[model samples]
Target chain A: MNLFLDALAWIVAPERFEGSSSLFVRLGEHLYFTAFSVLIATVIAVPIGYLIGHTGRGRELAVGLSGAARALPSFGLILLLVLVMGVTNKPAAAFTAFVVLAIPSILAGAYAGFEAIERRTINAARAVGMTEWQILWRVEVPLGLPLLIGGIRSAALQVVATATLAAYIGLGGLGYYIFRGLPLGRYDEMLGASILVAVLAIVIDAALALCQRLFVPRGVAAGRTPSLRTAPARRRAMVETSTAP
Target chain B: MNWVLDNLDLIGRLSLEHLRLSITPILAGLLIAIPLGWLAHRYRLARGALLTSAGLLYTIPSLALFVIIPPILGISYLSELNVTIALTLFVIAIMARSVADALDSVDGNVRQSAVAVGYGALRRFFTVDLPLAGPVILSGLRVAAASTVSLVTVGILIGVESLGYLFTNGYQRRIVEEIFSGVVMVMLVALLIDLALVALGRLAMPWARRPGRAAR
Candidate 1:
């Protein structure tokens, strides 16, 4: 406890506090890396996932690959990149995170969204002479938008949190504070870093949740709300009906 | 092949250490979280708050959580305790959500019938809800356990001795074989845990025998 207090005091001391400006700079760098990676991943993943999910060929392979990507340990992957890329932020942090973070949500979203669309609607669009791209843009993407957004939300949160581990490769971020503080027995610095990371995750997740609500079409939202609200009651009714006879 | 031959003993020791560090804490976390989740389900208003809190904990970066603990609790290799805490925080949220969802998925008639038959709330829960909900809860545990295997490796970055220690060491020292050994060990541990959990799920909840019948 004394060590913790002392660490806190050290962090607050004006002289020590002066060095803290770097913490903010590091945070900005971290966010920049994460944001770019997520953006790139979204662009690649969404389109690829849509194509596969719509085409219905090699979909199992695509989805399985994405799941595999997600399952691979970030620490191990990051370390592997360090070996190949030699510790620069661009390849080590930004590029790797893009590949690791983007695949699962994008694929799942596209697959779920495309699969959810009614077959007759697609047939009508095609029957009316819509091009394949037209059917995709006019029919699939719009309808799938809600689920796609859900995927992006998850991908964004994951990328932001995992990006902190970039500190291991000497790219500065809030993780730098945590990693540097740990070896030196600086508890307050670690606490501050942890709190900041946690808060950032919550803020990002909440913001994404709001975005999902905003971007999801009103019709879909309306459709889902009634079902969600009545699910329990429906189950209860089913129970009663089943037992009655 | 040459690399494996040279470091077989070291790899074996590291693998054993990683398994030791990961297994117990996750089991403990699952044990605690499932009951809390059940409680949350019983009380309607508490469910959202409980899940949200757990979700919040889930977001904290594993490395950041590790660094934060030593300062507060004081650091040691026994930092196993801290890793356990951090792992627990994540597992609780996951397990709780899964448990609540599973309970909700149970045939409502089962519960209503049990109630009508004069089975008390506790008895109904034990005999009906728990059995029906078991598969979903186990699925959650499987996910938590698999992830915990990976997360426990983060403990190494903070100075705990495990397979992750080998990975980090290999990176720092530029020993490719050691890195391979560490990576392979962690993956094997994760796979084994997943298989074990699946087997347990099958044995404990016969309903899980049919895939997709339980909550995916």
Candidate 2:
């Protein structure tokens, strides 16, 4: 409790907010690493996920690959990359870890989003003369936006949280405080940084959840009258798995 | 290759330690998550709050949770207990949601029939609902196992010994082969656990594996 109070006080102290290594500066650097990695991951993963989801090819392989990718330990990967690549360019090593960590969630999100759409609705769009590309962009992408955003949400939180490991490799981020504080016994600083990280994750997830709710097509959101075979369990499973990182 | 061969004994010991650290927490987590999951599923009022809290807990970074646990629990920062407790918390947070979802996936009519047949609540849960929810719960377990295996590598950063000791030591010595071996070992462990769990899931849920059954 004392540590918590000290952390709260440290967070509000004006002196703590303005220096070169101020909490705000570390926070900025942390967000930079997170946002940059997520951007690159989004660029790489979203397209691959989109292609696979749209064509329905390689779905099994992609799922297996993403699972393997997710299973890679972030800490181990960072250290391995840094060791292999040499410590001269630490950001490259750190970013690679972050990017790898971010990819599986985003990829899962993107493809799962596409898969969540009703096949009948997609066929109806095609029947109306939409080309493959048109159907993809016009029909699938819009409806899948919610899941896409949800995936990004998961990826962003993952990157933000995992980016703390970057400090281990001497890269600047909020993790630096915790790493430095541990050896120095600076509990307030360590706890304060952790609080920031937890709050950042929660705030980001909440925002994305809101985005998911808003982006879901109203017709789909407000389901049709229940038939005898609602398949409610299956539908719930789809939503649950798709949204999970 | 020569270095890896020479270090085989050390690797074997570390691997055993890693397994001990990773597997214990997962088993403990399963025991804790099932009841929590049951509570979340059984009560309408508790469902939202339970799920939300679990979800929130899942969002905490693994490293952060690891560091935070010592202070909260009043354990030594370097204690293996810190890693075990944190990983257990992680497994519970993740598995609880999966468990609740799995229980929800059990057919309503099947549960109704069990009730209709005069089985007591506990008997029905064990004999019917649990077996039916087995596949999904097992899938969640696979994830938890793989994740825990991978995460045990992080224990090295905090001065705890595991496979990650190789990575940290290798980094300090600038020994590329040592780091490579560590990474490879962790991946192998993760893959093995994932495959084993998949096989176990298949064996436990024979009906789910049949053709024309639900495609998991």
| Model 1 C-alpha lDDT per residue in residues A1-245, reported as the tens digit of each score | 76556555654566533464565576787778777888878777877788777898777787556545544567766776677566554455446755566668777888788988989989999999999999998888888887888888778767776678767777676677777776786666766677677777778878877877787767767889975775453233224443221
Tens digits of per-residue lDDT for model 2, A20-120: 88887888899899889999999999999999899899898878887787667777788888877778978898898889888888988889999999899
lDDT of 1 by residue, B1-216 (tens): 666788889888978888887788778787888788887777666787888887777767777667555555565524677787777777786788888888877776777778888899779888888988887787678777767787777888766777888768878886667766677778788778777878877787776687555334
**Residue pairs in collision within model 2:** none
* lDDT assessment of candidate 2: 0.82
Chain A TM per prediction: 0.81, 0.87
lDDT of residue A202 for candidate 1: 78
Candidate that would win on DockQ: 2
